[model samples]
Target: MKKIAAFLLSIGPGLFCIGYTVGTGSVTSMAKAGSQYGSQLLWVLALSCIFSWALMEAYGRYAVVTGRTAVNSFKTELKFGKVLAVVLIVGIVIGQWNSLSGIVGLSANALYEIARLFLPGLPAESYWAVLSIAVVILAILYFLLIVGKYSFFEKILILFVTIMGVSFLISMFIVLPPPGEIAMGFIPSIPEGEGGSLLVAAFVGTTMAAPTFVVRPLLMQGKGWAREHTSLQSRDALSSALLMFVISASIMVTAMGALYYKGLTINKVIDMVYTLEPVAGKFAVALFMTGALSAGLSSVFPILMVAPLLISDYKNGELDLKSKLFKRLTAVACVVGLSVPILGANPIAAQIATQVANVFVLPLVIGGIIYMVNRKAVMGEHRAGWLLNTGLVLAFIFSCVISVIGFTALKDFF
Candidate 1:
């Protein structure tokens, strides 16, 4: 029992990554993939998550051993690091903008649905009503962030992660997927159709996200984990990655069991309210809503912090969330995020765009890290082993292929 408690006590950075990773974007993507192609794409989810874990472990080790964040490594180590940081930050800002927007919009929509249960008089169908809820929520979040300490904020994130994970699992149990079919999902194979490739790539891209890597070092620093904690860091990374996979799979299974065969199209996250009913019963809507709300809240919280975190990294400034400028920047980001749902941009579409951007930037980021981590001057004895190096090389190639597929699919938009 003491050992278990110690393990929990030691966890911080990896769990923080998970809180941001398993957000509305993940839920939406997994749900769509499951509903469209059932469990045929689970292998993609597993593979993406494995790559995510590998990258995270590498990032964590770099931070703990070298005492350098990714942005810092980029600026000091590589010749074009500054230019790359600028370009990457631009991508981060745009991607996070879309992500937070989807998160706020989706959570507010779920809240509005809940409001309808109690206040039948409320205009439940109104987007403005949802927008109003989102505004209030974001305002509360801003206020909490400004006033709350890091420990308080971290606790809130853990709470959100717990609520979302438990609620989703409960809903999954109620829905009860077929074990035989789910078992076959372990075998990797793209579905036979036009959407299959896109869905497969999305599953890989969305599962881990680019922001998680950017925020990882910051979170490690925040946790006060040092080089001595390297083993702990690996444990935390593995544990969090496994938990992320479980939560993601549970969501996929829920969708597969409920909406897959019905031929129902899921365009919005809110559609789950209706689609989940027949399989999990009406009460399950509330469970799904609870999980979705938790997901959105957890996601929005980190997303709001992202701009400040990255900006600090770029400028080599202290990561002070309490600073007036940081708070102001975060406030601006919140407003931009809220605009997505208020302006009626589709959450799923925004998620896909952000994910594609992730894939597009991945090779460059991964390539740079590979160079940095392999240098004896940088890592010395702590450099990546052959196994990690091999995994990373494969991940870089895989990410490039996924990016090509994504760009090919969206060539018309370009």
Candidate 2:
């Protein structure tokens, strides 16, 4: 027990990263992909996790060596650094806030689904009920943000991540897919259909997330890590990526087993519950909803923090939770997050669109980090080696390809 506790403590930032990465967007993307394509897109998830780890290492190492967060590094290290930093802050905040709406919406809807499971008399489509739930959840989380410290939030995220992982893994085992089909999913073949391009792009966007890498250095800084912690950072990055793969794969495979084989699809967050109930039983549905709720709630904290955190990063690379600006910005995010539920928008669609849009910023993020890590003035003796550079270059190329796909996919939505 002591060893396990020590291990969890050591990987605090990585768990936080997982909490951010494996949110409702990821759950929806993986679930949608599995229900539609049945493990065919697993290659994308695998590649994204690999590149996520690589980019995280670059971002974390730069912070550790130079004692600078990503936005601060961008502002200080690059030519036209100030302009780039401002652009990144604006773009990521816009994207993350948009995501928060979908996240809170899905969370509220999932809770409603669970509630209805017990009380079948609840209205089938109660917008106010969902909005009320969203209000309460956001209020609670925002209160925690105001009163809690970074370590407190970190511990909370650890618990959420654990619930998400355990629930999904157990549910996956309950509806385990064939080993052969799971193995074949790694062979790398794109699904051919209308939404294939969008799902492909979203899979990459949600996993190899720009905010995850950008926020990583900030989290590491929050942890008070330094140059001597580079090795620890690498291990954390690897573990984070691996766990991302495991939880993501589990969600996908569970959907593949329960829905794909049974010829059903997930059109919304609640569809997952309704479809899984008859096929996998009430217990499975409960567990799935529990996992989804955990994913949604875990992500809300980081999503709310991104705008203020990046603004802080650009300003001085320090996180000041006590600042009025932080409080105001977070409050603004909480209100914005209620938009989807109040507007009665489709949470699943909102999440997918937000994630697809995230692809547009990836090239800049990957390019910026690569440029920063390679600079001798910033990194000095701790510059990124050729191997890391190669991974980043590949990530950049992948980002460009997915951006094009995302653009093409977005056209269909209009």
Candidate 3:
């Protein structure tokens, strides 16, 4: 137990990355893809993980070498640096906060589902009940943010990520897809349908997340790592990306085995619960919901922190958790996160839409990081190599294509 705890503590930033990327957004997008198209979109998930690793390595390397965060690097390193930094900060905060709404809403709904199983007295679908749950969850999380330090956040995230990973993995084994179908998912081909493009965009957006990379430096700085730790940083990035792929792929496979073979789809959070209960039994449903709720709560911590983190990064590269600005911004984020439950929006749809919206900002983020990492003035002797640069270029191009597809999909949504 001590060894396990020590191992988890050593991978703090990697756990944070996992906590942020493999949250409710990833769960919804991956699950939807699996239910609607089987494992056809697994290609996107694979590619996104690869690019995510490259970008994280680049971002972390920059921080270790220069002791700078993304926005701080953007503000000081490139042309129109200040303008670009502000735009990046604004775009990421807006998108992440929007995602937080869905995160908390879906979390509340999941908790309500679990509550129903136990109490059997609660109304079948009570908006007020869900809202009340959301209030309680957010209140507790805000209190944690107010009092907890970075290491505290890291330890909590490690626990959540462990639970989430274990739950999903166990659930997937119970409803394992056929080996042949899983293998075919590796071959690249888009599913032909109305929402296919949007799901594709959301998958990439949720996995190869801009904020995940943009916030890497701040996280690394908070961990007190430096140039001497470059190798450790690389390993952390690889492990984070690899864990993301495994956990996300497990979710898709679980949906594929449980829903796709039966010609069903997930239209709501409750649908996941209702559909899985009979198919995989109450034990499986419990595991799935536990994972989903854990994913949502793990994400909420980072989502609430992003705005204040970015603002602090923009001002200077340090993250002051106790600052007045940090407290105020996080409070605002918590309130914004309540919007979905308050207004009674569809949490699933809100999650997917927020993810699709995230695609639009990726090109800028990829381009900015690419510029910063390649600059000798900034990175000194440790500038990015040709291989890393090539990956970044590919990631940038991919982001552009997905952004256009995302825009088209949003138009259809309206």
Candidate 4:
């Protein structure tokens, strides 16, 4: 019992980050994955899991060892380095612009589904954006300015969402993928078709380049995680990051295997709630919706956190645990996060832009990560190992190659 308790405690950071990983994008992307490629890209998920774990640990360790966030570290670099940081902030904003819209839009879709049960015409397209933005601001106020401490609040939300997510994961098992098909997911393969390629870019963009990954290590630093750093803690951080990947993959698989595999793709996430009922029967979708909601709310806390972090970094100094700038930044972040959907915004546009922002910003974050990880001075004794380096190189190369492919594929769209 004690061992189990210790294990669970150790898993908290990873689990918390993992909860956020199962957001609307993961759900939708997985649904897309299952529908188009039909488990062919299952291998991509596997490779991503490995890559996410390695990168998170390496990046987080850089922050921990050097006492610098990725943003600040970039700022500290030489003149061209600052240019890199500028590019990073700008690009991430673009990539996340689409993704941020997507998250709110997906939440609105889920809410629309939930509301259809009680009041058929309650939600409009504009309302979702407003509500999402409102919720983000309110959540920020609650944590940042009002309560002043978010540890307990964050923990509870993560726990609740993780439980909600796990319910969906279990249902996927009950849906019973063929052992052979399931095993085949472990093998790497891309799906055939142009749409498949777009979906793949979106899927990869949804989780990997998303702002959430950039913030996880920051969260770790804020939590005083490095003060007591250990190999065990290092492993724990890796576990947390991979756990993020695992839960994300689980949601995708659940949507893909149970929903998408059945030709049940919808334009938005709420469609799953509608379609899941007819195909997977009853409880499975309820579990899925609960998971989706959990995913949405888990993000609320972090979206709130980003504003202040950016502000403090912008102020060009150490983060004072207690300061007005902290409060202001926190408040501003929440507002910015929530401001998008004011007075009712377009749900679909919001949804698509949410990840588009991430795509735009990804190059900088990726560049920062690669540069830092390779700088042995920053990482110290716990610097990138051969295995992590290999994975980083591979992921970096893959991302670059895919950028070319993605550009080629979507050239006409642009």
All models: lDDT? 0.79, 0.90, 0.91, 0.59
Q: Could you tell me every candidate's TM-score relative to the true structure?
A: 0.94, 0.98, 0.98, 0.82
Query: Looking at candidate 3, what is the lDDT of residue 21?
Result: 93
Per residue, candidate 3 scores C-alpha lDDT tens digits across 20-103 of: 899999999999999999999999999999999999999999999988888987898789999998988888888898899999
Q: What is the RMSD, in Å, between candidate 2 and the native fold over all Cα?
A: 1.1
The count of residue-pair clashes in candidate 2 stands at 0
> Model 4, 232-321: lDDT tens per residue?
546866766566666666665666666655666656555666666776765677677767766665655554445455545544534343
**Deviation in Å, model 1, residue 130 alpha carbon:** 0.4
The total of clashing pairs for model 4 equals: 34
Cα lDDT tens digits, model 1, 193-267, are: 666666666666666577788778777777777798888888888888898899999988888888887887578
State the TM-score for model 2: 0.98
Q: Which runs in model 3 stand beyond 4 Å of their true positions?
A: none
Model 1 C-alpha lDDT versus the unseen true structure:
0.79
Report backbone clashes per prediction: 0, 0, 0, 34
